[model samples]
Target chain A: MTARTPDSARDIPEATVARLPVYLRALTSFAEEGTTTCSSEELAVSAGVNSAKLRKDLSYLGSYGTRGVGYDVEYLRYQIAREIGVTHDWPVVIVGIGNLGHALANYSGFRSRGFRVVALLDADPTRKDEVVAGLDVRSFEDIESIVAEHAVSIGVIATPAIAAQAVADRMVANGITSILNFAPTVLSVPDGVGVRKVDLSIELQILAYHEQRKSIAPASEDAS
Target chain B: MTARTPDSARDIPEATVARLPVYLRALTSFAEEGTTTCSSEELAVSAGVNSAKLRKDLSYLGSYGTRGVGYDVEYLRYQIAREIGVTHDWPVVIVGIGNLGHALANYSGFRSRGFRVVALLDADPTRKDEVVAGLDVRSFEDIESIVAEHAVSIGVIATPAIAAQAVADRMVANGITSILNFAPTVLSVPDGVGVRKVDLSIELQILAYHEQRKSIAPASEDAS
Candidate 1:
């Protein structure tokens, strides 16, 4: 294996990439609590991961904690934030202003964590001009103009399953390359487009699978 | 490794466990499309996973596709459903009537996918008796009776960050062994209780991380 360099985002394992946000959150918690420095064990506990695994994941980003002295909390937090590209806010547009979309629009976490909701859109004509999260609901046909205006690279789809694919197609055509899909359907995007599906039912099913096992065999290991 | 047995949920790897629901969904789609059998490649394409990984994941549950015939769609679907313990609907309770909670209550996917929302709960007195998704919102103090009456094993925490821990504590005390937390807080549960967090901001941050890398080096591989 070649030696990894700092700021080199290439070739980082996907698993490590997923955990980076967890680590970033933990670092933020430490900094919020006035913590200046912390050992790997401390950060791992805060992030709900084991120390060795956390260190290995961090190593991919070229962050190595110092021996005995530990890591500087604020500096490490910034490094992770930069690595994850949250150092600057990214303008985002939400398509499908339904119940889930309304929740996403009013979600304060998005604005506080590196994303700004530039628009809320829906296909219903009645929804137009309605204010949500301080943004007026716009027609889905306005995607092209919205993307061009705000330079939105990320789009969120909270539409029903039947409409998710069309919304994704429109988003991709309008130059929104990254998607966070809450719809319960499989989306097909081109080679360069990125799509992430958040299915609440699937998550609950996973938990149910484990819960069933616990009842069958009480001796089974607890889910951490 | 020792030879695996069917219906033995004791040692299924967590990674494979996570993907079981995805496979189940793909199988459901195939069944919906009137497909009686499907090759691993076809199923993998539907599930957005590689053929080898899908096969390996299924193998953990003692399911091996025939050499030429592939897998029997309905049988495989039933096996997965039984393995995931979703053959019958599990009773669930939601402990917040806010925007996200409202969305969850009205989500039709949960009812169709092995879960029934037995009660909608809120700590706010004014929210009591309010109807949501055809169910009356109940007081948070009634969790114990509600859990006992419906035999609910799963609880969803949609409360704010400050109230999540207390809600989780109450759920655990009332025999809800599994929790799906949407609050942006790290919950501490005792052993034998399972907690899964769904953070919208964290998911967006992950997408932003990769999206940032894409802009930095367009030559980088696409996020799958």
Candidate 2:
């Protein structure tokens, strides 16, 4: 799925890079639906962003659109995927085969996109030999050997908050530099290591903020 | 847990609001460590942001810091929590008692923060008698009754992608205004209904992007 070469790869903003995969996903959907071309406005609606911002994001990848014909869906999809390095599948390790780890292992989205779960490790001895999503759960002590075998650079931490930092330390010691942390605790990592946390409660709290506003506004307006 | 009143609540940016929970969590951690006060730099390092950005974000909530005294950790924590409306517990409903739903129901972070799971519903009849995270798994048909009983405004969709839209439609029809979708699909809802997607694959893809860059840069530089 790799492209010839990426012309404007280095200077993309972090925010824009974060949104490129989203644009790529939207474009892939359009291609699957038999759409050949789409204007920025149409793609923006599908990507859930405004057309102007979409144009700015796309421009960072290089000029791929026709003057009036808009973008070729398949071409744009490949470009963004290549830009995001999803063109080549990356082997990953998941530590802590708990409920969240089980869900992540069974997640079809990862394989469909660009990630391959090469190993599933758990600290519990009972989980050893258990099969999940076609992979056998191994002892957490096998992390170094498994990471060396697969040459995995990215790791997922689904362990408890208390165990998260310890697992992260082990992963980093074994040369894993990129981590996707699901634990609620904040991890302290050395420089050049990338950590992105996905907290389920944080998302709900943000929604609660808006929901509270909707409930309070009417009453306050009436009183005023 | 509520505060006196929130100043400049209406003018806070969505980005800042989203980060408030992160900041609040960091402050709570500091308070737990017996720390009574912290400078913006210390808090920013703990929160994984720059000190200047953290200061600007805190400024939007209110003037809570002194010039040289730094911020009172407990006071700032409560103010941010109140501003984000997490001081009041929010009743929530979970649809799909599958592996993901089971994990979410058992997730202690939700209860410790602001969310309370009132009901767990699934479409499968076999799962009705099952109990997860101490809550009985009810039938999906009970959605309306459960929602009405709990007055739940927020819903979680842990169903498969094929069933996500139908579940969302039913949720919206039953008066759910905000949704946290874990399903790997884009949901279409009526205007004014908020949808926040937490895609496990998207986060992995972002990390892969940076990981890819690190792997490629040295090779390219050597070639040049």
Candidate 3:
């Protein structure tokens, strides 16, 4: 998975890249609370990861932390933002207009970040009457025109499981390479096209697994 | 951190454990489609994991699949379920009764996977009139009694950001050790407790990160 492109000084590991946002989020909290610096242990506690692993993950991006003291909250955040390529605006499109889709379109986080929701596309003509997050819902068949016009590379699929793959295929055919699938089913895309899934059921199920373990080992003080 | 007990290989890696439910969901889908057996490649495509990684993960649980053929869909599903402790009933408490909370309480996935929603808690006294997921909204003060009576080890925090930590603190005080946080904040739990967060904004931010990368890179298709 670390297959690097030519003339690069080795890329960060995918696992590490995933953790960068976690660390960035932790740093953001510290910044909000007026905390200027945080040791690996403090950051790790906030991020819900181990301290050593946190340091190791940060090391992959070069030493942005002071050796003995800690990492500067704002500085580390900037470095992570720069590495994540969110310094510039990113145009995005949402392809469904269901209940989940409405929640996402109404989400203000995208606008706060570098992402701009360029369009909202729906398959049903009846849904065209709907306006979500201040944007009018358009027909899903207009994806190609929306992608070409807005130069959208990222698409969000909040449609049902049956419609997810078709939406993904259409998104890919329209030249969109990255997708965030909220659908329950798995999606198959060609290599180089990134797909990150946010399955609500899966997350809850994972929690249930741990909840089961806790039931067996009911001793609260048992770190073992 | 590698702070392992004398029996180290026994404790499942948290990362691997997270992926197990995904595989279980995929397996359930296969069974629903009447697929009795499937090769690793086929399962990987449906589960959204690398085939090699999936095989490696399954190997840790012992050889359950046939070398010449593949895994028995029903057998593998049962094996994964037993390993995850989902075969047994898990009592879960929903801490907030908002729209998202209402949706979660009514979600059939939990009932199918042995997670029973024991009660729904709400701080708002006026909401007692509302009925959600066929369960009447219980008062916040009933947490201790409900947890004690139900022996709830797992808790779901769907409260808003301002009220999330407070609810989590109360849940922890009532002996709940594992939490599924749907709020946007990073929760601070005591040692020995597990917190799995599902922040909609964070997931979108991650997608935006990948989406921004594609715009910067050339459009030429490199068949890597």
Q: How would you class the docking of model 3?
A: acceptable
Each candidate's B-chain TM-score, in sequence, is 0.94, 0.92, 0.90
Best by TM-score, which number? 1
What is the TM-score of candidate 2?
A: 0.90
Per-candidate DockQ versus the true complex?
0.73, 0.69, 0.42
Between candidates 2 and 3, name the one with more favorable DockQ. Answer: 2
lDDT (C-alpha, whole model) for all candidates: 0.90, 0.90, 0.82
Off by over 4 Å in 2: A1-8, A218-224, B1-10, B218-224
Report the CAPRI category for model 2: medium
lDDT of 3 by residue, A160-184 (tens): 8889999999999999988999888
Q: After superposition, how far is residue A33 of candidate 2 from its true place, in Å?
A: 2.8
Residue-wise C-alpha lDDT for candidate 2, range B1-224, written one tens digit per residue = 26635544456789898899999899989999999999999999998889999999988878999998899999999999998898889999999888899999988899999999999999999998898999999999999998999899999999988799999999999999999999877889997788999988889988988988886664644535
- Model 3 alpha-carbon drift over 4 Å, by segment: A1-10, A36-45, A49-52, A62-72, A215-224, B1-11, B50-52, B67-69, B125-128, B215-224
| Per-residue lDDT of candidate 3, residues B1-224 (tens digit) | 56534431346778888889889989999999999999998888888789998998887676799998999999999988987878887898998877567767777667877689999999999987678778889998999999999998889998887799999999999999889998877788887678888876666666666666655666667568
Off by over 4 Å in 1: A1-11, A63-66, A218-224, B1-10, B63-67, B218-224
